[model samples]
Target: MTGDIAFGAGWQKTIRVGRDYISVKLDDPSFAASVYASLAETDNGDYALIWSR
Candidate 1:
């Protein structure tokens, strides 16, 4: 349940939360849905949901 995610390019960044979760932030609001969807694809019950604000 511990890993590192490199967002690669663009204005997005990832913040690691200890060894359990990661917080993704998108500077370009347009990529919110896309990013959320991508992360959601990897959901395996370890997480509740991939959300954006």
Candidate 2:
């Protein structure tokens, strides 16, 4: 969570509740590509992924 998350962005999301903390990162481009390819092979129809703050 301390590295590049996008073209020029870094460490995009951080959250803490009580004594716990969490950091999130964007999926690696290659991994994302592979996921999309696998999804295509399944022909699961169109879908959408949404993220919001």
Candidate 3:
């Protein structure tokens, strides 16, 4: 799946990691390179956005 950032310039595309976390690739024209991140569930039922190198 693909989605645009709310009130932001960039967009995100879902990536299949075959794990419990939700992986995505983010990109924008101003960015030098695409960023990869994952949303992992926290103990409080919230999600944390973890940036990957």
Candidate 4:
């Protein structure tokens, strides 16, 4: 579970196992639209998504 698209920021409850096993489940249409806004470079030199509020 590298990329985590959770409702809130956490490691326990929102722990992502794997992409094949767990894809981000955002059923909330409004929340979904807000979460997927843009992409940005992470400090780890890898790419990650920038979710909007």
Candidate 5:
């Protein structure tokens, strides 16, 4: 699956990492590089956003 995130006046693209997570690539004109992150559901039924350097 794929989607878009609204940032300011523009949109960023996102994709599904697996059956359990949705990944998003974040980028900006002022940033040096793009950042990747993923969101997954927790055991308690809440969602968690996971990222690494």
Candidate 6:
């Protein structure tokens, strides 16, 4: 799996991971869930304007 942060005003900035497996079995769902949980309370901490995709 791979992670990237992109900032410039316009873009998907999505998390991209390449693998030989099916897309449905992509990056750890648990991991993503943890991440979302951690950030959900940020309340715009992303307001720093840095895009972490």
**Largest lDDT belongs to which candidate?**
3
What digit string (tens of lDDT, one per residue) describes model 4 on residues 1-53? 58855463322122244221122323355553543333444558776654445
- Overall lDDT per candidate, in order of appearance: 0.43, 0.32, 0.65, 0.40, 0.62, 0.27
Which runs in model 1 stand beyond 4 Å of their true positions? 1-19, 29-49
Q: For residue 52, what is the lDDT in candidate 2?
A: 32
Once model 2 is optimally superposed onto the true structure by TM-score, how far is the C-alpha of residue 37 displaced, in angstroms?
Answer: 23
| Model 6, TM vs. native | 0.16
Candidate 5: deviation at residue 53, Å?
Answer: 4.7
Give candidate 3 regions above 4 Å deviation.
1-19
Off by over 4 Å in 2: 1-17, 33-53
Report residue 11 deviation for candidate 3 (angstroms): 14
Kindly indicate the candidate among 2 and 5 with the higher TM-score.
5
Q: In model 6, what are the clashing residue pairs, if there are any?
A: none
- Report the error of model 4 at residue 9, Å: 27
What stretches of model 6 exceed 4 Å from their correct place? Answer: 1-9, 16-48, 51-53
Query: Cα-based RMSD of the predictions, in order?
Result: 10.8, 13.7, 7.7, 11.6, 8.9, 14.6
lDDT (C-alpha) at residue 46 in model 5: 94
Candidate 2 lDDT tens digits, 1-53: 49744622223332253322223334555654321111111236553333332
